[model samples]
Target: MLVHENLARLLQSYLSAGLRSWVQINVRSTNQFTYSEFTQLLPNPTITLSFKINPLPGICLLEISHNVAFAIVERVFGGPGSDAQPQRELTEIELGIIQRVVRDTFGPMKEAWRNVAEIDPSIEAVETNPVFIQTGGPTEVVAAITLAVEIGEHLGHMTYAYPYSTVEPVLSRLSPQSWLADAKHMSPSEEDSLRRAVQGAPLPLTTLLGKTRIRLGEFLALGVGDLVRLNTRVGSELPVFVGNKLVFHGKPGVVGDRMAVQITRRGT
Candidate 1:
């Protein structure tokens, strides 16, 4: 389910936003299997998408049933009533097309996650093979994408398995700790107020203040009572900013033997 959930999220991001609502993804099961061995286990009529990620077993797989495959192909090639049906058997050309489409869709999703997770984005497509599956009486055709995610440590390394039904559980398990831990992380009013507050805040003045400058000649010319003209003006309320925006204004004051800002005005 974890893999399925990941795939669904990935699919949602890969496909057009308008198409997201029309598609459904489910996780069937998840297990650990070797890339070569997994491919051998696939039924005759299958579609595989292959890509590589170095420093680990450079493979991952996305398998889909025939019904799903037809649906996807129909969508990609336009809609139903189109001439997308394979003649008698699935061809390598058809498999290649499926692979390209899947690769195009998933490549950006992988990159997006990589950026968010701070991982490398060096995966390359190797191949996409289609095979046929049979369960009982010709249930439907199936396709799979076998991707190389990383270089394998061993000659016959095992890869993670995420069949289509376990997406929700996996996503639940990987949900952000802070969000999961806090029941009331943000109230509606608090979130709305924060949005409004950020919108109304004044722009940062740090750049206007400019950088400090001091030359060796000037240093030698320094004397007692010599004033250093700072960008800040005397008696002017100092701005307190975070992330380059004014949050508060105050005058300098002594508090408990420490210099502190005494609030003179509050930022919006």
Candidate 2:
């Protein structure tokens, strides 16, 4: 339960950012089903995404409703999001496009479970019809998480199913302590990586000399060599900026053959 709730929060925020839209997610139901039963559980024409979680024995499954999947596809293609269902199997071209969203369904799992264990989940396959995939034993039980996703005026559901045997070993690790630890501390490697990324980033540096205002006719009638008046004194200090924000003050001067600003003071 803790795992599911945490996953929901991360998934909602991450997906909303990626899709550039408002998205709401909620846990609709939690239950268990036998492997054979689960395979046939979703409606026909559903998009089935399979993933392999490292250190786990079997592949996990994600079932998305036809309406919801189609709505997402339409939204990606610049259409107003639709709740209409798709009546036929997706073609190769459409599948290529939708595959990105399919792969991202479990993209948040690794981060959500990082404190408990560093797990890697890779896409195993995407099946338009569940009947085409070969899965586990008929009697194996799988835990299922049904979630309702709301986008605009449309509401749809997506389900994530994990084999009971595969996740049973790490069930004890999904606790409040793990979540708190993740929130309280950034690992040493993570901190170092963040620092390096900041250090490597490039910032645009520029110096604003002065500003002036003139009438439309005066501007239009100006010649190429004509000098325009500025609102600053000849020897006054000018403001230096880095990516829009004023960072320091400098004096205008010449460096060999080029014009320059010599830094005189820092910005408050």
Candidate 3:
């Protein structure tokens, strides 16, 4: 129990800080099963993240329950993380959102395992289906750690499966003693962390003024300040985007010295 509790406390600190939410993690059960048995235990439509520890030989897995995934999605979109647990798998957009969080969620493993061995946990892939995942031979031992994940009023589960080959080298020093809370009062990372997580990423603001087709002769003959009619009507709203996503429509304007766009409406 102490072992589980210590690891839980460690993860609680990391997740709370990264997500900026009150998250409680308690290890529900721990086991060592054969790889074949491990496959049987996975939920089909789960968040299966494949990762590897530097200096270790095999890929490892961490499966998150759907409830937790959906809750994270809702919270990131400016809603309370508590939502009705759905029976279906996550959508493409939902998967992308969780993938970002998962990347952040696992990066701290290297810190937690520093005493055991200097290792790095790098997420290799995220999949909803586990059909093609392979961590080790069918008969190899797999250590599984299942935790009860809670955020607000919603509750779910997360299971981590580490193959023997991956953790064997560090087994001697892997102990709950190494994972005790660094701070007695570890608080959630800055207020509204989810909002800041997304806001910090750089976004390109590209404007599409108009479109037109020109023949070889016409395009070749174009000169500076030449007038060319466009498909769009004058004074029409221009489309502003980030990559392929249309974020908004705006009208062109100028302020003292800089040309700018005044958003007319949000994109659909």
Give the winner by lDDT: 2
What is the alpha-carbon lDDT for the whole of candidate 3? Answer: 0.74
Write down the TM-score of every candidate: 0.39, 0.63, 0.61
Clashing pairs in 2: none
Superior candidate under lDDT, 1 versus 3:
3
Candidate RMSDs in Å, in order, are: 21.5, 14.2, 20.5
Q: Global lDDT for candidate 1?
A: 0.43
Candidate 1, residue 257: lDDT: 94
Q: Rate residue 64 of model 3 by lDDT.
A: 85
lDDT by residue for model 3 (112-191), tens: 45445567677888887777775678899988889899976779888888888887786654654432332233335422
Model 3 lDDT, residue 163, Cα: 89
Pairs in steric clash, model 3: none
Model 1: per-residue lDDT, tens digit, 142-221? 22332222111111111223222322223443344533353356567535533443354334443233235799999899
Give per-residue CA lDDT, model 2, range 27-118, as digits (tens): 78999999889988776776788788887778788887766676677777777765566578777766666678766755677755655667
lDDT of 1 at 47: 49
- Model 1 error, position 130 (Å): 8.7
